[model samples]
Target: MKNFLSALAVSAVLVSCSKKEATPVPEKADTAKIVDSINAARTKINDSIRSKNHFKDFSGPHTFTHNSIKNPGSVHFEKIKGEADHYNIKGDIKSGKSYVHIDGFMAVVSDKHMNFTGNISESVAGSENGKLYVRRGTKTFMSKDGGKTYRLQDMVNGSGFVEYIDIHF
Candidate 1:
């Protein structure tokens, strides 16, 4: 009888030891689904705007003339040190003695729109540093020696223009 009891105890211990433990499964996050939903909503808004032809009035054909600043060798805007909204615009005109260097601030109108407006804070041409306004998708104008002089670098065929920059934010 004692032997029978000891055998039963050993069998119970072995069975308990041989059993496998179950591991818990982790749940997946829904971040990807949320991002996809936001992207779909933005696309729907853009499609609605396009269907209404909201941007049709701002479209025009570009004509390059001799007066235009032709063939800019290289143009680049670098952020100014210690200034978040300020930038240094530097560029060279091909085959021309003129050089352009200006300080400006870029303002974003929307997630897809932006513009630059500032003074020709400095220039090599002369003391003609004046207000420089470059409206994206519209026109670019520079005033030299203050507002006393104005030069149209680029413009559409209309008197008034709406400017916007194409960008995805």
Candidate 2:
């Protein structure tokens, strides 16, 4: 009987030791979803560039003001004809010192729109091989590659918004 009890205790220990908690298997990432997201970002960047190009033939003086709740001040552009035609841009932001007297090539200007292409001369943001677009009383867009890519500079409550006030040519 004593031997049998000892055997039973050993069997119980073995049974308990054999039971194990299952480990969870790792799930694979969805490659198709990742690819789709990347494609969407590329499409957005391309679209922005194309939109900036739409105003490539515009010139003359212009002003852009934020229409949103956020007050980023304003931007002003004046085309000057000289040895090389260029535009002087002044951006007055409420937060810091204004970007004053920046120069870029005035590529084109129409009755209601204007475009400026930047080079190494301009010290403003997006002034390196960039382009600025302004449509009268509508919107403003800036690019870093002569309209090959663009971004709306106006912000609404600190978030990016396309709307601008009196973006006149």
Candidate 3:
């Protein structure tokens, strides 16, 4: 009887020991990169105001119809550009704000109007994928579905800064 009790206690202890520890979820790795991209796109768009010929945003017709351009033919996916209509708290109106940019491409999330607060994380199909931008040249751009995913021939042109304002895209 004593041996049986000892065996039961030992089995109980072993069973409890076998229980696994909860694995910690690692944090997203590319946060800073995304922020940088969004900032760069914003800067490029801002620059466009003074020069209409500034870095342009290309889409369906712009990508395919133009014989001067070449690509995989059609956007990897399609990102719709959303308008940025918000302004500073100090009563300063943002003429047009487009904080994000894609190379010759761009997209605006249109589910609802978004307000950027200097800090932004990429959102797509409703998921917070990655940081918005990284350095291509002197400007930044945005990525929606992590770096791996993309929107086909989409762009938000006109104002560099993003606001609720609409664009050609």
Candidate 4:
């Protein structure tokens, strides 16, 4: 009888384990909140007015890659010494205003990769010295190496135009 009881208990356990969980179905009306949430989401970053302070100011060297466009490239900018407090990211818009922070449903559709150069100097890692760009708003990008000493825009080439480092095949 004990053996039979143990087998029954094992069978019950297996049966219970085989049961599947139901996925919760959200109410249809709840999805209506999408439009309302979008309207209310206009508080900061993507929705706010852009300025020089919208993006980050750095005190070291860093690598930034622009991977959102059909084609992509990179930039290596080094932070000038004694220029942190006065640091500014200078930028202008091509179609609309720029952002200083991350915001909204704005998919930063472009992929980006950055490596911060912690307290880097001209002595080592040899930085590119005078490259500048505008991301959005008034925030501008700056580099110090003919825009090539550090950042590798191999996919594109620099131009007199400030935005969109034009790359031609």
Residue-by-residue lDDT tens digits, candidate 4, 1-169: 9999999999999999996889999767775688778767764444344323223443332323322222233222333333222322221112112111111111111122122222211111111222332232221223343333222222232233222332111
Better of 2 and 4 by lDDT: 2
Q: Pairing residues by index, what is the TM-score of model 3? A: 0.21
lDDT of 3 by residue, 50-160 (tens): 333222233232121111122112222222333232222111111122122223323233322222223211222111232233223221224354432222222322223
Ranking by TM-score: 2, 1, 3, 4
What is the clash tally of candidate 1? 1
The CA-based lDDT of model 2 is what? 0.43
Worst 10 residues of 1 by lDDT: 55-64
| lDDT (tens digit, per residue) of candidate 2 on 37-143 | 99999998876664453334334444444333233344555544331223565544332222223234443333233344442111123222223333222233455
Model 1, range 1-169, lDDT digits (tens) per residue? Answer: 9999999999999998996888888887899999999999999887665444221122222221112333333334555443333334433332343333333454323223334565331122221332233223332444334332223344321224322111111
Q: CA lDDT of 23 in candidate 2? A: 92
RMSD of 4: 20.3
State the C-alpha lDDT per candidate.
Answer: 0.39, 0.43, 0.33, 0.31
Per candidate, the number of residue pairs that clash is 1, 4, 35, 22
Clashing residue pairs in candidate 2, if any? 58-108, 58-109, 59-108, 59-109
